[model samples]
Target: MDAVSKENEVRLRKGTSLNERLVLAGIAVILCLIALPGLAHLANGQWLGIAALFALLFGCLLLGAALFERNVVWIITPGEILIGEQRPFGKLHRRLIRDDEVSGMRLRKSIGKSVEFTLVFETESKDTLTSPPLPDITQVRKTTLQIAWLLQLPAPELAENPLDAANPRIRLGKPISFKRVRAYRALVVLLACSLSLPFIYALWSGKLSALGIAVWSLGAIMAFVLIRYLYRTSAFWIVHDGAIRFERLSLKGTTETDTVSGDDVEAIDVESGGRKDSLYVITIRLRTGKKIRSPPLAGKDQTHAVQAEIIRRLRLNSSGDA
Candidate 1:
């Protein structure tokens, strides 16, 4: 690549926030702390030995996730995209590819538009490729459309702005997205709280067993700590250079910068659930009959905001012919 081409390759830079890394570490520490005492108590019995082994296994898993958190990164270069991910062990997983290799892209609108998924670059030579869920819908669409536009020499006939009535994009400074905890984590917290409440009530009434109450109390504390840690640490971001980034301190991180030029994107859509109160999903359709989905769904207002901003950028790029 020439100097100009190399410069164009560095379109965006996005990283996972430090807050997320702290949360992963916190969760790991709590898991180890909780498991240690339980494992020690099992030394005298055969069943306890087995239980200790399981506890140790769990601890290892959490610790591994915590350490691998540092490997997260999403980078988009002129010819390709790069996603860095955290694996079970201390290994870093990466996916790197160019626009020409991408088969197609589409934005998926899920139930009530409450959820959305993106599909990109399904190669004929391979049966399957793993795609992680992205939290920001607009970024997914932007990345998808950029890839599609970059691959084709000429643009399609689709409308540049599909929804004329929608408002224009207002630069919201830096994009922010919360990489919230998922269903399993929420369920564990809820169950722990539900089980602990009765024990506390019984203790207050002077009818509870002290040992039982202590166990319940400890479990409840762990649950609260874990949930809070997850919430505070999760985040996603998009920066000024048409880049899309997603990261969880411990779970997954991906970034795509140097998107296809705005002039090539044919249309964009911000969608949400069926009912008025449902969540939102953003979809971008390229001129090549390709569609791209954002990471997941967002609130209705947030979805609208991102969609408007992307469209605005596209328009501005056209006016300047940049």
Candidate 2:
């Protein structure tokens, strides 16, 4: 690469800003400060400060996340596109696609009209590569279209984005999507409160029975382990031209993705469970013995709709193996 090329590489990188990192670091500090009183109470043996324990753990995780939150970066060169991430203590995962290996790209919006969008890239061998759900679709689309032209693939139009309209019916089955962020937050908060209520009541009434104490301990453990998974954004599965891709953010801020070629997936399973509220979850079992689950499905209606659509698109609608 020449000097001019090196400068261009620097120019095109989608980078983590210094200000953004500072703000995250600031919030991490604030959370640690908030956890101090909880630690003091725990030191005094007031176990009632279990809420503070969860906070302290969460704060520490935030501090780590803030410190190492964003390392994945995209770079466009004169020849191809490069996507790379700097891992813990500075290990790196890097993939470079020359113009010839580039197949195609599309924009996916799960919950309509949102800042975050999933950009999918397909290779000649049908491998699926995805960008982490990104907030700046405008810039992403511009870069993607440039690359698409270089590879001689069809351009994914912004106006035809998934969020642009009611999802078209199968052959393009409407995607089963999680509700917007606010809805998920509300549901999580409501459940957390309900779980905590029994302990809170017992604490107030001064009737701390052995069973009551056990219940509180169980609830606290559940909250500490499950809250991160629950409160995080739901994973999304997108199917395009017979290839299916799944993407979600891990609690630690890395993207989790799984892709199965259309032919490799031998079965689609949908099972329903839950008390009063119907919880339907999906598991995709491959001929290779791998099982992939969709982000937990929370509501009755969403479960039904998503199951129907995914099965339909996969052309296994007639089989009810689960």
Candidate 3:
């Protein structure tokens, strides 16, 4: 990754490094070699030959994708910001943001020990245009400040912590729904069923004994328990009368409500959780040191919005109490 600045413009470029490309190429070659014996069995119509075919195809696909990977370039001018993905032949994707349309720049950090910072452009319409993951906080801060200076925009301050950067949407005092939670639950169930296909096949083939039945039953029960624990049927959050309430509807059509009063609330922030920290959730810290968290939200933006709104309402209530 490198950035260049000229009299009238600044340009940032990033792409797959040569060493990474070489490593990928080496892996592809190994995969192809491993598939060679399986390919030879194709003449005898063996199942191994079918598996080999898939392996060879996958290797080729990986190699091709690496070769065609595009270099990301961001060109910032006084009038507009242009972001594009450049291939050897031409630009693959291009986006332009006019200066007038941009409200400000935000430095967003992912939630994890190995944190990544991304510079996001907040538009007048509340939409965000994000940059590629930056290498370090120092570089990202410098880059964001430079762009802000060039555009005559406010230089974004570095968040004291990831939670401090959480900003609520302008629209508050409304219900925030997690409609996608249901779809996510459905997908989990589908995946669990897909994983059980091998056991079902064995049972259908009459190869399972009493022991096999017990094993399958145990596996199914575990999967059900995990899925039930991970997801709720539906959920939403609302701020009303100086408190934030989280309501969850279960599969059994029972509604559970968890409300934290503004007086007891310490802080509201978004945190990453679930499966390698790929999902974000809203966490509320109480004065007593207990933490309440919502289900994995639909996306980081939504989670932050909820966090912001809850914090905003808490502040409003605190002022009222005073």
Candidate 4:
């Protein structure tokens, strides 16, 4: 801790969250898979055709929201900035930013969708650093201004509305959103409903004989496959200052959590450089012979950047090379 960090009152901040909702919903979905179809006709589930379709589709959204709620927040102190996930269910992946490293501060407009300005920090050597996306809210804006004052950098200016089309701010680096895309959810929900309706109609009309039951069972399997896809698609990594945390939960009620210190990570790797979506993935191999992978992120550059930064920090923090 330094004088600046010591003088600053420690505070934590976050945006509107979907944390517990996802956890509980995902848990319910997990339990539903256990003999629900065999015990009850197609899980007796009107839920899937109408109500539950959205649930399966938005599985990634909920997972991402939960990760954001529990982990994705900023903790500011006078001497340093703390970043990463902060929650009991999430491994606390905290990165400490010293006052001396930050050479400047600026407000930047993000790329794509509704543009929003977020606080960015420049290193002494002029390398740019960014925090999680921030909307044009008062508290974070105030904090950014205060940090600029403390760092003796050019203060970040306000943009009209970062989420608006009129955002006239400098754009930098690969953009990331705190939430998943809405279109993916919508698409999934549509598919689920398409699969579910025929079975529901057949059952309601009492036309679902043994043959119909067999058809419904097959449909049920497909729905599970889709749900599992969504669940696994939600997998991702949160890069902390000196550590990394990966979350992988399947639709089958199985979860794997890995919190690896910088010293333990052997390397970071990315695949499908030019591709997007599920085809693009990031992998981190640890010294312990375990390899962790990330879901499809925006682009290869972003993955590579995060990987390089983590590996660099890990090497710096560790006595041996990464």
Which candidate comes out best when scored by TM-score? 3
- Report the C-alpha lDDT of model 1 over 244-275, residue by residue, as the tens digit: 33333443323233344454456667665454
Clashing pairs in 3: none
Tens-digit lDDT track of model 4 for 128-150? 76665553222345556666665
lDDT of 3 by residue, 85-119 (tens): 87645657998889899988877877554445677
Highest lDDT, which number?
3
Candidate 2 residue spans exceeding 4 A from truth: 1-15, 43-48, 87-93, 132-144, 157-322
Model 4 worst lDDT run, 10 consecutive residues: 162-171
RMSD of each: 16.7, 18.3, 11.1, 21.3
Off by over 4 Å in 1: 1-19, 43-57, 69-74, 77-79, 82-96, 108-116, 127-135, 138-143, 153-322
Model 2, 1-322: lDDT tens digits are 0011232342233335567667776887887788777777876778746777887788778778766754666665656768787734677888887767867778765653223455677878888877655433223444455545554568886534332213442112223333443465567667878988877888899987989888788877776666565435456766643556777656664567666665677677766644334456667888888887665554443444455556555655456332
Regarding lDDT, does 1 or 4 come out ahead?
A: 4
Q: What is the Cα-based lDDT of residue 275 in candidate 1? A: 47
Off by over 4 Å in 4: 1-106, 113-153, 158-194, 199-216, 248-256, 273-279, 316-321
Poorest stretch of ten by lDDT in candidate 3: 165-174
Residue 112 alpha-carbon offset, candidate 1, angstroms: 12
